[model samples]
Target: MKNIILLVFFVFHISLFGRNLINPLNKSKDKNFSNIGLYIDGGTFGIGYSTFFNIEKYLSSSKSEKIHLFFRGSYGDVRFLGSGSGGGSFFKNTQTIGASITMITGRGNHHFDSSTGLFYRDESILPLLDLGYRYQKLNGGIILKGKIGILGLGFGMGFSF
Candidate 1:
């Protein structure tokens, strides 16, 4: 009688498992799709575009997913960059070209942003620092950012993915 009962229990478990009615792991069907995007930024250095890659997954041991890094370069007109422009400017209309590193932290689509780096124009090098807010999509979509720092105010919008 005990043997018959064991066999019946085994068959029931197999039937439920075969139909995916008893999922033990409960893993999602979608993950690690894509993580990259590009956008245009306008500010003290004029208008320019920047591309960013998501590096949080590689650096974090947990799966929380809340950190990002970016590189920036400026082109066009270096408008208000000059001696009295918070150390990042050097005369108006100066062709500005430089790079910066930005770090972002927070949760969901909202985040706190910070950036620092150096750029050169007209044979002079200047530094930059900014702090502001960022709106980033979870999967991939539109992105917006704003900041105020040593280099003045900056704002930009673009897409990600």
Candidate 2:
């Protein structure tokens, strides 16, 4: 099930953002960026990574606020170390999958961001929300965001491609 979901996610990303597919809107500098970042907590409650794209910009509308739709997932290893009968350490892994929609408003490299989403993690469903700040370039470059909210405090670093 995990593999299948991951596969579907990758396929979805390719179909939507592949450079080979010619879209007239992609020519515009502001609309051409996609982001992938390593996140810690960030309302996810677990350490993982996320990828997102500018949906509104991709659709060719230059709205007051740009909306980004993020697809996030992770297979994380939780290790228990002890000095008991079992003697050493054991590894328990967990799977997480979620999607979020973020609204961002700003002119260029600085922006105010807010996000809300839901996730299935460790056999439980969780709600995520956050308000934050983002630093990223218009064409494509690095991405940095810090947020806090219902899920907790979180930070991310990645490149906008």
Report the number of the highest-TM-score candidate.
2
lDDT of 2 by residue, 50-78 (tens): 32222212222144335433444433322
TM-score of each: 0.56, 0.58
Q: What C-alpha lDDT values do all the predictions have?
A: 0.52, 0.50
> Which pairs clash in model 1?
81-89, 81-90, 82-89, 82-90, 82-91
Q: Pick the candidate with the highest lDDT.
A: 1
Give lDDT tens digits, candidate 1, residues 41-124: 655544332222211111111244456554444343345423333554445335555556666777678988877776655467
